[model samples]
Target: MTEDVPGVMMGFMENWQGLSGTWRVTLVVFVLVLMTAVTAFIVSRLVLWLERRFANTNNLWDDAFLHAVRKPAMGMVWLLGVYWAADAAYRYSEAEIFQANEHLLRLGFIWLLVWTLIGMIKQGEQLLSTPGKVQRPMDYTTVSAVSKLLRAVVIITAVLIFMQSLGYSISGVLAFGGVGGIAIGFAAKDLLANFFGGFIIHLDRPFKVGDWIRSPDRNIEGTVEHIGWRLTTIRTFDKRPLYVPNAAFTTIAVENPSRMSNRRISETIGIRYSDARQMAAVVAEIRTMLESHEAIDTSQTLIVNFLAFNASSLDIMIYAFTKTTEWVKFHEIKQDVLLRISQIVDSHGAEFAFPTSTLHVPDGIELSGLDQQGQTS
Candidate 1:
């Protein structure tokens, strides 16, 4: 069409005036409808081909762009087709209703563009944080924050441009916003606080989604399921959902057990007083075992020593940390260590102590109340 613009325009004008009023409207609508359908078909096929092409590549932007463009492009095609059809009808019939407003036409395009950008951001976010989708997946919380920020920027810019197109002064609107923001802030202070609290969480990142978090200030112990702008959803040990306001995180001291490098195995075992001579060997052998054990981390303060002496037993402390932080795996490791320690004690002819008592009697004060089998004599 650009190759012969003058020829095409002259030919179009010459033939356009030659058509009858009814035929002109019908021809315009038919031609535009056909053009819209063709354009929409082309866009879909192009998008499909692009998707297949981008699927083989690791670049996420092309895939996201292809996914985000399809529906909006189709809608835009139909929008322009219908608008031009109406304009043609109004020109021939002098009808007031078929008059398409150019302002609304421009605004529609702006809105569609905004929708496209927002859709692209959403797609990009999913691709970024999804495990196995990318080589180095981002943290879900950080991806969500960045996506929301980008979307907000796109929407705000679109709104400002729309207002500017409609002849509203940007400075005047900003001034009004500044004045009204104070009133809104006072009225919705709690909401604002929560918003800012969420922002801080995004910035500081003390705990993120999937972390096992507990608060010392409140009875809140759970795995984080979601981190939203207002509330953070936690799934407790008992499989209950806990909704905590973002503002609460600001005041509470949270312990994220998920981030712990190792799980501790601290236990005290006692041997009978009869095994007093075996205590030193037991302590030495246990320390040696822990140091050589595959699961125990010897670098992190491993201590095995005689702790205290109970009434009937000699206490020994076993302080160590396991290599794994997983709860189930840690327990399994601890069990294996305990079993090994028990076997070590048994190998030395020592036994674990339980509560027992022995009574003493003076030699002459004891009278015979019964025979050897406790029969009265």
Candidate 2:
């Protein structure tokens, strides 16, 4: 074995000596770099071809994998080619040069691994962004939370690997991590609260992406666009996006008005107090209008009646349910009902009531008692 080792070393030395000029060294490095670049270009084209092929197949996972492979191709090519070139450079049997080359190779490989993992994570996120087959059983909030957690795990693993390559002991690193995590938790209590709040939002299923939610803490009504780890995004009716912290969401009463299958609309109309019969007719007309309305749900009974008496008018409250929960359609239905009821009341010679207050005074008192008249003592 010892004789074979010298023979092998001599052969290796001969190969190195044959290639030892400045120009040869430069040529070797250039050739390695060019080959790496060519390999990277080929990989990129191959990934593109695979992606196009997968696009034809109508399968998603393959497409995502292809997309992920394209990103790390260059890094991987450089990592492999550079390490091999570095190994080819050691002509002497000295230990120090070999150690330096080994360290550099490990560092480069670590970097490549980190970025490649990141690329894969990016692809995962893109894939998870699409709704699942079961009509998105998990809400966006939950998906986002889980995706972020997985990403964090990837980053932590890469960091640990990098540290290990740098000669860090596993136990010492874990102890340091435990202390660091505790310190981070203490310093970022509110941030941790927000993260937990995001978890609650996902688990509770109070509202979902595209839900029209109103916050009790703020007078804002909008559709949910995205639910993130720290904040939830809502796109308002006015087309403005609002970002509110997940913790704030837990603090407020979130009214998910869009969750209902149908919307119940109730309104009260009034007529002159002197016209009781006319008020009853108005109620009947309102009820008939609601009953015949195409947008109203016939499954539920519509109610319209003279509810009470005001000082100047008789109050009639009308209650009905719209067939749709869509805000635009509900508004249109309500507007049409109001117009039709108004026309019916007007044709019956009864008017909608405007609230008024009346006052009584002594008959002997006159306008002259007023400050401008100056006629009473």
Candidate 3:
């Protein structure tokens, strides 16, 4: 291949002897540029056609992969053209110019390849993160973190390759990097802690992007927006954006409401003391209502009892869980249940209690005058 490259160039240049060295090089570059442009255009069309075909198919992996590679493939075409032009130009140029152009072209090609790999990794992460697509679906945060880590690895490897290509000793660079890394570790301890916290979060599967979580130790309660290496973003219920250190999740108990299979409904209703005699019937009817309600989860615990006698009323406890964890749906179910309970109580001629107190006056002793004075006072 090495011998054939020079032969091929010579054959192409045979008719261009009248051209000066600069013109010859310029003509060669322009031809290569034109070829690269045409090739890229054709390949892009071909890729679009493939994409259309992939879109029609049930397999999404291919579609994702095609999307990932399209831009990089076009970039590679231009890089190849530059590489060919540089190789041919090297023969006509001085040693210093040749070396510089050669190194520049090589580095460009290497980085282009790195970019391509990173794009593919990102696309794969997105594909894996889509819910119900994979056997074991990964959440968006985990996929994003993995993609970033992979891209970092690619960049580091590319840097090392670039250094080696530039004639740097790999062993020497590694030795220096070890010393620098120690210093960096000490300087960025908090960053590392947050990064490790994020790693643990992904591994433990405690919560994920879009999950509604509240921290017991902190005021952070909201839907997860994004989990980064050093911080996690949350969009609070009030629509405020909260930035929290990832390490906070490791130290605090995070309540993931999104993971719950059911939303709990624990309520206490008070009836007037005069209706105490009908408490048993009311409790039984409430229990029956819960059991028969389609929205309530009968598989879980359901309890209704005349639980306590308060100072002025009889307190009835109703504890149940709705089948749906969705906030809107759960609230609707709860409203329906409460309304039904109210209707049942009314049917039994029981009145819901309000805060009230009755004062007793002892018989005799001119209490009317004293009470009148007290009332006026």
Candidate 4:
């Protein structure tokens, strides 16, 4: 038995030796790799099914986010599997190829992890915004702009961190960036200005979406639809889309008349100067017309003897505010008020003033001379 024990031990050592090399480790790694791939495929299928079923039966937005995240999630799962396999095959370090492959897998896993986290952040953004939080007047544009900016920041930060993790000297990179940043800044000055302008718009609540804005330099009357990085898109009342630079909005005077709770209507009507003695009567008539108008805000009504004479007419100005914020309603009210004033003047025996030239003969030439005048008398 003692002699046979040595042979038996030798046989066991031979078997152990066969399984101890890089080949055996490689085979094991391969099996693990295959298992991970299959697991990922199954998980991916499950995720897709869950996404579709949940989307159709419940939250559609989360489904969209899941769809966007699907590939990234699968990549992460495969990466995790490879990482586990690499750890299991640690005894194969003698094979430089496998060692390098392990390092590559580790790096790949990190990359996939970053991508997955980014997808999660994007999905979270969508979920957070689905709760009717974006129902405010300008909230949709603001939230969209902010979401894009956040993603940009996230990408930049992730890239820099990954570079550092890859053993690149962060200080050297930062120093190089400092020099290059100036040139890049110069090239992207306008773009950066608009980016900051978006923040300014958020901080300083100006005209909201759907508010008509009139700039001083140009007739930019439109509804703000999107606030982007470099341009703010406005849909004009005529349905033309105007892409205005963000810088212009900061510098230009935007008259947001639509933001006002009510509209103002100012007008002037001229009466014949010959009937100037009925000035008080005319004023009373104008006041009555303004007071009775449903659209005009009576609190702001101002009836005045506006002017003495202009060419051939006496002009009276009637100023008032429309109780509506709509331009069409204000126009309609102004038209009705003007019509009422015209009818009032006609009723009071006062005519509308028009440009007239008076022609008179000389005093001595009147009535065919003084003799004819006395005889006719």
Candidate 5:
């Protein structure tokens, strides 16, 4: 195939022998460009056709792979065309200008190929992160982190290949990089710590993107927006964005509320001392209410008791878990349960307590007041 290239060019030039040198080169360039354009058009159409065919299939991976490659493949086609044109137009010329141009085209093709591979890696991440598609779907944060690492690997490999193509000594470059890396590591120790923290997070699988996490040691409590190499972005309940260092997750005790099987509803409802007589009945009604509540998780522990006697009231405790971990739904379920409890207490003629005190004086001590005088009341 290599030997045939020159022969093909020679035969083409022979056909154009009647044209001057400048006109002959011009015509060759024009022909190569036109051929490249036509080839690229055909390739693109073929890809689109394949995409349409894949769309009808049950295999999700095939469709994802095709979608990932489509744009990159088109770019590659153009790159190949340019490389071919450069090669054909300068096949016989030994000029430095032509050689440099050919080199640049080759480099462009290499970089474009690398870009395509990186794009495919991104698509693979998306496929893995998609819920219900894979047997074991990865968390979005883990997927994003892994994708970043894969892209870095792709870029590093491409750079090495590019360096080698440019006639640089690979071993020497590696040695230099090793020494430089040590110094850079020391200089960016915090950055490296955050990076490793992210790596540990990926491995540990503590919390994932979109999970509601609260750090007891920190003021951060919200849904995870992104997990990057250096920082993790969280969107708070108040709609404020919080950028926290990845390393912070390593030291903090993070609570993943999203992973909870049930959301807790714990409260102490105090009733007036006068309602003490109805406490047993109130407790029984609340217990019944919790047991039959649709949103409450019956499988979990449910407690409704007249547990304590306060200074001026009877304390009734309610502790239960909701079936859902959703923030809104959990609150809704909790509110409904509380309302029903209030109604039950109201039906039992039991009033809720307020801070109150009553004082009494013995009959013998009451006679000390000034007789018929406003001096002391």
Candidate 6:
């Protein structure tokens, strides 16, 4: 066994020295690949460790960063490993493909960086928008707006750098863009209008994601789901998705019922004319009930008064606001209030009115001579 070891070492060295340059290059490439595999494994393990470590912290930045870096870092490592391997091979042949290795590497680097940033932006947006995920979560609309804007900027910058890396002069491109922009603007005026309209919406913030909005000018009534640069997506009450161009919002009047501090309950109730004496008492009691009701907003206007006299009944109007603005809850409160009003009217011995007619017969006219027959039989 000891003699076999010496022979094996001598033969291995002889074979190694006898190999041609191409074979040596091939071996080098294989070694490089093996090293790349090992390095990738290490990176993956490290990322997992850091992810676990950072997961315990309340800060969102580290988590986002780690998530964004994983795939891009892996891609970059593989890219560099292959580039180096190819460069080593090209050193012998001076291949055309390998000549542009630096440019390719630079472009790949830019792409990976953009990818990382976009991933980070998405993660951060999610982290910030979710309720209770952070100490002070932001509204989803605002977070989405900021994230989309950042992603756009990152993509644009990456494209510019990519162009420059390809030897395209930035100044010349800018000059041409300036001239082409006017023509593009004229051609796509409506699209541009929508884009700017969305921008205005972001700035003014009349409504946001999850807001219940309606437009009197157009048939647009829904809850906003997503506010994009071109279109804002809304989920209708019937569960249909409605996509509206942002430009439409600029020309229309929108009502955001979600933002209302309180829901108003305005109704006119009618009762028989016989109940006229109880009107004042009913009104006073209803007003007093509203003033003390737990669900009513007494800070707002509350009026229970006789509005007008109808043809068939005496009309009373109830004008009050509820403390809650939730649609279902408001209706429940309204139901309770209406039921209480009915109880109040009943307590005062008043009944609701309906259409009725009256007949009159005077003295004793002996059928007025026309009831039996027209021929006077």
RMSD of each: 3.6, 5.6, 3.3, 8.6, 3.6, 6.1
lDDT of 4 at 280: 76
Give the alpha carbon lDDT tens digit for every residue of 217-278 in model 6. Answer: 98999999989999999999999999999999899999999999999999999999998999
Alpha-carbon TM-score of each model against the true structure: 0.88, 0.80, 0.87, 0.69, 0.86, 0.90
Question: Candidate 2: global Cα-lDDT?
Answer: 0.75
Which candidate, 1 or 3, has the higher TM-score?
A: 1
* TM-score for predicted model 4 compared with the true structure: 0.69
Cα-based lDDT at residue 13, candidate 3: 74
Which candidate do you rate higher for TM-score, 1 or 4? 1
Which portions of model 5 show Cα errors greater than 4 Å?
1-11, 14-18, 88-93, 105-109, 132-137, 361-377
lDDT, candidate 3, equals: 0.85
lDDT of 4 at 368: 53
lDDT of 5: 0.82
TM-score of 1: 0.88
Global lDDT scores for all candidate models = 0.87, 0.75, 0.85, 0.72, 0.82, 0.87
Number of the candidate with higher TM-score, 2 or 4: 2
Best by lDDT: 6
- Runs of candidate 4 with Cα error greater than 4 angstroms are 1-45, 48-68, 77-138, 218-221, 236-238, 304-306, 363-377
Model 2 C-alpha lDDT per residue in residues 1-377, reported as the tens digit of each score: 31243234345445675665544545555666678789988888888987888887746767777776677776777777665555544433344665576677777777666676666766766666666523345455566667777778877887788788789997899998899999999999889988888888888889888788997778868999988878889999899999988888777888899888788889987888767777666777778778888899978867888888777778888888999988788899889888998899999987777888877877987665457555454
Q: Pick the candidate with the highest TM-score.
A: 6
> By lDDT, highest first, what's the ranking?
6, 1, 3, 5, 2, 4
lDDT by residue for model 4 (109-169), tens: 6676567666766665665555553343335456565668777877777677777767888
Per-candidate total of colliding backbone pairs: 0, 0, 0, 0, 0, 0
Candidate 1 lDDT (Cα, 0 to 1): 0.87
Lowest summed-lDDT stretch of 10 residues in model 5? Answer: 1-10
**By how many angstroms RMSD does model 2 differ from the true structure?**
5.6
Q: Candidate 3 has what TM-score?
A: 0.87
Q: Answer with 1 or 3, whichever has the higher lDDT.
A: 1
